[model samples]
Target: MRLRRSARIRGPGGSFLRRPPLRVNVASPIELRPSPDGRFLACGDQVGWLRERGYGVDSDGCRALELYEALYLVERGDAAALGADGAPLDVSGLISLGSKRNPRFLTKYIVYRDLRNRGYVVREGYGLGNDLRVYRRGEYGSRDARYLVVALEEGRRMSASTLGRIYLRALNLGKELVLAVVESHGDVIYYSVSQFNLRRRLDDAA
Candidate 1:
């Protein structure tokens, strides 16, 4: 979906309020089916629309939406991907399914929603050691993803080695590593992580 440019609007207090980019409405609700693999949601029709919005991958003839993408669509009321019972799922219902599928759904959803609200195009970060791959606004197809982002809850403990490994992977892939921390109150803060190599200094002749 194309995002409308940011604009300023008058507030109740007569102060100008800045509006974030708005996504264009989908023509109609897209239909999604659960794949037998259980790793993705498949759409038999309107696959092109989903693709144009950077939602999923085309497998054979169908578009396969990532679990996160399906959840996001449900949240936006753009699509009604069927559940196991072949019924449409609401946001909460989708969340339940996602949580059952992946234990980190809550934290990931917080970070995903935050990024989308900021106007970035986000997709699953498969094989990238992150939760989402983000493309800057207006740069989805023209350029590669600018950032690979991982979500963590505030004050959550992570081993230094794990962080180092993620940093190294991002470095190797030429992508920036972003850590999105969701606080208890649902606020999010982003940290950029990168690796720097320092050459050892040679000792003077003793």
Candidate 2:
């Protein structure tokens, strides 16, 4: 995807600073607290703020932002996310940390960013055998997610059994299953998959 040109924001020194391409209108910058488990970011008091932006709240009634969510928020300049060490991270810094934690970070980011750009509400799929639970635009909070997206590198392959499991889960949940293939050049292609069965009838003439 082609990014929009950076907008100039006046810095403390009266010089212009380059802002990120994506812009989210918010009253204040969202705060992200590192989770105790060291896997996700917790929005304690900022839960409502993030939720208002389409971030989903977990069963615990708090918004537990995933790595991709936090990265996207930080990249879009809508949130100031501190790491486990309580240090602010720029986009490049966050990318570095995310890459270190997840080997497929870049591929997932490409797909996630692309989906968000297309105006879908994306949330991390917890234990659903997918990368994201995507809500159709403007249907968030009013309806269940319409798609379960699994992000994979362009050339990466999945076993038939694994694919079957994922398809079955989506089918049971009554959601469409999408495979987002991220190429090395930062392009994403999406394919929807559904299950079907067929039987052949014996021909009497044969």
Candidate 3:
């Protein structure tokens, strides 16, 4: 007679413990963006910002998912290849997507909405006729309407060193670089430019 194993299992020493086989969970695909250099980024899972447990999955899944997202972004003209940081980039007279098909485009849109809700005057503006710009009600302060540029686009080819330099420049400009890398429709991974901030601080020290 064969004994069927239940959800719970008994050990050799007659100890009752729950030793179950790991299982894979079915997850829906999420959207993310890649750097202009064709490098994947983590934008969090389609579910949320938290990781699921006992899912028998890892960052690899997130990376694969990111690749899938890259495919989609490339299909849309919203993404394009651009030169690296400070490489004599001549964007003048060049047309930009202006956040047409960005996956997180709505997030920034909401930020503008929230600012408007705060009784701040906002207007539609683009940087020297480049991308869109955000302006306050009045007064030309540092926080006035500034040009928003997508330094990197999904599915663009670039060098690692060049990417690093771009990230460093963003940190120097007091901007937190956010990136999302999804793996294989499994999970999405996200990170920020904290390291850039730290490194810049260190450079200042030196």
Candidate 4:
């Protein structure tokens, strides 16, 4: 039998690994609590493991994780989300709770997991009516975001005007707009969107 001399480990494809993981093969899952308003789940700043991976928003010296973030960690066996009663919520329970907080939470989570699995740092998005922001792979926490993501269920339709508006907003923000469609089978399909003026193109060519 062999034992690792050092405890350092990179968290689930994390880049800024400077300390030991929050928990390493520990029997008990690390306990996490929700904010007073039940919007975010937190467990103090000890979650540097999550911070290095760009998972939570820090507040008052604590890093509070979004619903998608906490749910992902719970599924990965690294942490457990606790309810007000101080009982652990399973993945399904967390999903139900998250749904109340954000009706599109499940959809967002599907896309978030897919993006993270494919090696991108996903952050919460706002102001652009976007669902998420994706940093270029390996650029999170250091560089500006590369893409603004909108997640939707498969077979859903969006008017060209709405999509164009989103694309234009992303362009104005100096970012590309990406659409993530999740299928019933939990598969994710990605589409990059941009504003191209067909009318202007025809007029200029003419």
lDDT: which candidate is best? 4
Candidate ranking under TM-score, highest first, comes to 1, 4, 2, 3
What lDDT score is found at residue 183 in candidate 4? 70
In the range 79-135, model 4's lDDT, one tens digit per residue, is: 878888888787778878887876767777877766775668988886554378889
lDDT of each: 0.69, 0.68, 0.32, 0.70
Give the per-residue lDDT of model 1 (tens digit) for 1-206: 22232232231233322433233577777777788877455555677777777878888888887777887776566777787787877666777787787677777876776677677888888563336888988998899998888888779876666676777777677788888877765566787764542111111111
Residues 7-116, candidate 2, lDDT per residue (tens digit)? 22332233322434655475677777677754445546667666766764563766777777887777677777787788887666676777887787766776777788
**How much is the lDDT of residue 61 in candidate 2?**
63
Name the better of 1 and 2 by TM-score. 1
lDDT of 3 by residue, 45-104 (tens): 532321221111135444322222222222222222232342321112011232334443
Candidate 2 regions exceeding 4 Å error are 1-19, 22-24, 39-46, 56-62, 126-130, 196-206
Better of 2 and 3 by TM-score: 2
For residue 98, model 3's alpha carbon misses the true position, in angstroms, by: 13
Instruction: Show the lowest summed lDDT stretch of 10 residues, model 3.
Output: 86-95
**In candidate 1, residue 170 scores what lDDT?**
72
Each candidate structure's count of clashing pairs: 0, 0, 20, 0
The alpha-carbon lDDT assigned to residue 79 of candidate 4 equals: 80
